[model samples]
Target: MSRHILPPKAGHPDVICAAVGWDRPLQTYYAQVCFRTDDEPDEGEALIWRGTEPGELPTPEAAIAVITPYAEIPPRLAEQLLADMTATIGEKDGRHQAEVKRRLFGSIH
Candidate 1:
């Protein structure tokens, strides 16, 4: 079964944006923050992240690990973003894909 914790009309998230970002690759969106206009073309899926308590991040490593769940990409995207990943995202040149990801990131929040 699926799970959603955000409550509507309570200042909670309303939709999830699951996409294969070029930069982040696959950001698994779990927040309910989408619109009907957005639902049709993209076929959005919610993303979920994992992070330690907000207050537990006092050091650099801790800070990096904490509050990370909020902006995690989907597994597919993450795999591509991996530094050592030598996989082919598409048959075309990989540089184009990187450019697309950069532009998408710049255009959105």
Candidate 2:
């Protein structure tokens, strides 16, 4: 199962995001972001931001970072969480970047 990280708070996280994949040839990372509330559990996990148009991040942290400021979590908490999540996810999979790409993009090769 895909790992999902929630904010270090009660109930559900105010924000959710993930590194979907990487376009190695383009040196770009693909990700998605969303906002969640008690009434909108489905809305929060949906893709509010996606890396398709350009000027997006090439790393999961960066992708998550882009949304941190807007998230309900405190800035410091959000940053720490983003860093921890990035590292944890990376460490969990040796080829985290490639695996993310493959999982999200689907057989880019």
Candidate 3:
């Protein structure tokens, strides 16, 4: 799971975007997106999309298509969110790989 805080915009003051991918069999993944606003603390999360496959959430167009049913998101901001998700996934995957390597080969000096 990874989260990125969207800066306060003209109308929306507090928005947060999060993406989480679960590993599936055969090296596939299921990804989901969540949106939250600080103003509505008790409203709970707004689920943007739950992808059937791993590839759906990485691109802006695909993500926008998925999120459109729930909430309206600007193209530019959607693109930015996609970029952040990509970076976050990369970081998480890298860390997991390193951990696996360390466990198998012992600590590398």
TM-score of each: 0.21, 0.32, 0.36
Task: Please list the residue runs of candidate 2 whose C-alpha ends up more than 4 Å from where it truly belongs after superposition.
Answer: 1-13, 16-27, 37-47, 59-61, 70-109
**Between candidates 2 and 3, the lDDT winner:** 2
* Cα error, candidate 3, residue 24 (Å): 14
State the lDDT of candidate 1 residue by residue for 1-109, as single tens digits. 0122322232333333322211123222122333224445354343333222222222323322322333343333333333212332333425765576467554221
lDDT of 2: 0.46
What's the CA error at residue 61 for candidate 2, in Å?
A: 5.5
Q: Rank the candidate models, highest TM-score first.
A: 3, 2, 1
Best of the candidates, TM-score: 3
lDDT of 3 at 106: 64
Better of 2 and 3 by TM-score: 3
Which consecutive 10 residues in model 3 have the weakest lDDT in total? 22-31
Candidate 2, which ten residues in sequence have the lowest lDDT sum? 1-10
Error of 2 at 95 (Å): 23
C-alpha displacement of 102 in model 1, angstroms? Answer: 19
